[model samples]
Target: MRVPVLNPNYLLTSVLFVLFGSFDCSELDMDGEISLRLEHSLDMGKSWQDRGSLSFSKARSAIPTVNQGPLSDENLSTLENLCSKNMFYLIKVTGDGIGELQSYTPACTMLDSSLAEQITLFLDWRGNPVAANLASRIGVVGHKVTAGKFDTRVQIQSMENGPTPDTAAYIQKMEEEKSRKMSGEKPDNRSFFAKYWMYIVPLCFILLINSAGAPENGGR
Candidate 1:
């Protein structure tokens, strides 16, 4: 006996759903004492599952010594280990009456030597300076990390900026930064629509087909 094949349109729709569903995006709200959040998605870019938490604080520091740079043999060795082990690390320092300082390094192992060098330079140049500037302004530093294939970018924001126009503005800013870093485009309506065109187009096609058949199918 021969089995029947699934309809092509059905197969296509299923594939599309799976593809779009595999892209897992998650948010971790760091509440207290170092925490680790893991999310995994099998499809290229559709949905994700939380893999539970790992105690990241038990590992080595995420941020290297500023004075040592990336070329230091110690730092290089650390980087090699991090790369081989594929680690994600975060550090948080909180002081009374002073703003908190947080650092995140994700997918630290994928970084090439050159990129690692740049990262070290960036940290040495902007990390402390930015933290000190925020400290002077009576603001605490809140760090967030988004990991990528080759490199990771960190964002440091002020926690004591007072009530802004909106409570969720920080999330929006982080989303924009992540979108920009991933797409090389600013987070705007156009970019958002572009990113989701696959879904939009398919929905539009279904709508058009149904609308065209509606009048012919019934009097109502």
Candidate 2:
């Protein structure tokens, strides 16, 4: 009896397909809120500056809300004003009819590394230590900023104040793309095998016949 040799090309192609498929589905378990970017400049009239952007998608969903009294149009206007302005001012967001107000300085220059540090510190006060000095310099008191149950919205009042644009629309579009995957889509059905299989298979049969007819280990 004679054992048949497997085609090397078939073996190589199968291995490549399996490796690519595995790499695509590696991270399918972790669940976290999507973050959106909020960038603004410090100057009010002149060109806008890139102060620093923050991701609020995760924060918005994670924070709890309380049942405050009816929100006045004035309050909504105030929060919207804070978000759209370019000055440096402090925003005191109240939760459940009780709120406190605080003030801070705004970034004077966009490229100012010191100011950038201050902003990062102010934002991260709830998380780390190096953030303390930065927050202090920027006049941001972590505990002073409060929120209400229904106060799920974020207020971005500037201390020195300037013109900040609402970039929510753009951020939402980008997030939508990031969470989408290529699964359930049609796979590529065109390959060397699919296009020329008929010809190749017949050629392979011919080769096998020729090989068998050549000799049997050089013995009769």
Candidate 3:
């Protein structure tokens, strides 16, 4: 497979951690350790099952806020290993002072090196600033990872068809970004082939070849 560099819009603070932020985000705790629980939803949010818990050595914010730059890589490699799955993942954080912060809703994999690249954030659906403020009680100083390239741009999921203020804002933001890129307001310095070769090369060498050649003759 043709390898491509990390998405310019998607920021990987450290070689290990990938971060996304937006208007509605997660709360951070400064004291004590926080327990990160993973909830799996094969059919969107219809049914959620308790998968496992992610334990941070110290308190941290699961979501990145406005003032919060790029989230550092605390245990990204470990998370990639443990959090590898095709189903949708809902990351929830629970700890002292902070009851529960529904942090990340993402399609996660250790092999993002090959997965389709799109920088998106899960916006705030709860609209609970009180929760956010309560969440803010836990500071993100030493607890949160802070050792990678900082990226703070997130596009909303327009294709998913969710009706919410955060989603609406995200869609608008994505449209604006697209317009800007088209109008040269935002320049793309990356090569076209690097970004697209992986998708193209396979069709020519594998799929097309398989279709053109004779069938595998009784599973060869």
Candidate 4:
């Protein structure tokens, strides 16, 4: 068998380059500080630049906003600081007391060549909207993913903060919906077929099959 020709020094250099370039930083920020870090990248994620970090604790306490109301200018400004006036951002919720760190890096699409464009991070709570205005202002999308001891749930919503004069009206709307749902008001505007389309569609198919299987007879 013929032996393959190879350059030893070149291979060693290539290995060293890969080892150096593939390295990453996994260190978190400081302890006990729940915060959102805004970052962006050019050249298709070959490199990145951190804009800044906005503390959740600071923002929540700084604003007098309750569970329901429009997004305050103060709070908006707090989030705006994270972007450093940039239109696009990569949001990362850092700090302590947060359970299992998980991340989602979506594939770059034709609509969005850069993953950092319109990146949204949602911290879901019982009565509050999941940071809607912050997302809209900084160009981010939404989702809630939780890992339980024995279960997991994921909920995704639009980045829209709703109509003007009420940038966070959806919070109030959600509360109202929860009230309606708790009061036994089901959103059953769908027709019987629509409501049970899964069963109805398969059942219709079965009926059609049976009818087709039956011999066709015309009265003589």
Candidate 5:
């Protein structure tokens, strides 16, 4: 009786598939001592008026949905003043004993008496807010909130996708370029010597100098 021998290539591929599939992207500690607050500053961050509060817990899912409190009269008045001056509306997020402020002169908010109600908090994979204070963690960011008229609702959401490069298009482009080159495409029509004349000239000059300095008959 002969025992079936597993192909090494097949075994390696199976192992890799299992390892990659088992890899969980949500590795951050959701139970960390962190809190979020939606605040605004009319005086360019000189002060902050808290408009809403956000809290996270371990009992809930890894990512929690935050429903912001309605905007007050002061908030509306501040927005109006900033819109009149054509200045930016400043927003500050405080978490883990640190504060992060962002400023944007949104045209939507300026043109109409509108405010971006929905706020999404992009957190690092390690369950920390993707902030400058904590720069070591990896996360996906660049979220912008556009305003809706007579609305001031805010929500904080966790980062769904980690820092995964979407390089399929780039890889496809490279493969096409490679295939084109393999198909005898002469994108650079210049000869090798023509393309590398500077290097070749320097090398040839060095060889000539060496030959001139060398004694005749192999320095005998």
Candidate 6:
């Protein structure tokens, strides 16, 4: 009996599939507080205003509150002084009211005419807000930029810290597609001669031509 020959590439692919399947692939359940506040200096760091805070966590998400009023004289004075120095005004972000506060220095001058009216907040995988412009030790950590005013926007976004891919769903979809393709396939019902007619017909034609052209069988 003739044995079926196995393909080397197919064997390698099967081995890789088995190896990956054997590994335990599970998602980690990580959570934390994502409280953030912006402290702005209106008197060139002499004094500051602690803006209303925003929260972004699995438990609850928040939006920034409107400033009670426009920038006070003190705030405007601070911004003008910093602008004269060609320095950007500093924004202090307190994360969960713990650890070192992160700083956000907008390139815009603190003056209302120059200040960018919008800012975005980004969250890490642990649900903590990080500096949007600073380089993260853990790499990019934002999913999307939350759009809000420079002072009141507390939009939350995840970077690389977003959720892991849903492998289970992806695998299920692949399996369904594979099964569908298998079930949709039609069986080969042609006779052997019909399946190999091209090769058989060519060889038969060559054999007939050779036979007709050859000298008649030699006398016995």
Alpha-carbon error at 209 in model 5, in Å? 49
Can you give the lDDT of residue 121 in candidate 5? 46
TM-score of 6: 0.42
Question: Which regions of candidate 5 are displaced past 4 Å?
Answer: 1-34, 56-70, 97-113, 131-220
lDDT of 1 by residue, 1-220 (tens): 9999875434544654553343222112222233333233222114443423322221124432222112234434554565567653333333333243333343242243233211211111111212211011112222221222112222222222111122134335546767797987744555645544554465556445423421211001
Error of 6 at 113 (Å): 4.3
Q: Candidate 2: global Cα-lDDT?
A: 0.31
Per-residue C-alpha lDDT of model 4 across residues 2-28, encoded as one tens digit per residue: 999875434533543443333222112
Which candidate, 3 or 6, would have the higher TM-score against the true structure?
6
Judge candidate 1 against the unseen true structure and give its global Cα lDDT, from 0 to 1: 0.32
Q: What value does the lDDT take at residue 219 in candidate 3? A: 12
Output the worst ten-in-a-row residue range by lDDT, candidate 2: 125-134
What is each predicted model's overall lDDT from 0 to 1?
0.32, 0.31, 0.33, 0.32, 0.46, 0.44
User: Candidate 2's residue-wise lDDT over 137-194, tens digit each?
Assistant: 3332322222211212332211121222223443453345335534444544567476
Error of 5 at 95 (Å): 1.6
lDDT of 1 at 125: 12
What's the CA error at residue 203 for candidate 3, in Å?
A: 62
Question: Whose lDDT is higher: candidate 2's or candidate 3's?
Answer: 3
Off by over 4 Å in 6: 1-33, 42-49, 59-69, 106-108, 112-116, 133-151, 161-220
Which is better, 1 or 5, measured by TM-score?
5
Residue 128 lDDT (model 5): 58
- lDDT, model 3: 0.33
Clashes of each: 10, 19, 10, 3, 1, 6
Output the TM-score of candidate 5.
0.41
TM-score of each: 0.21, 0.19, 0.22, 0.22, 0.41, 0.42
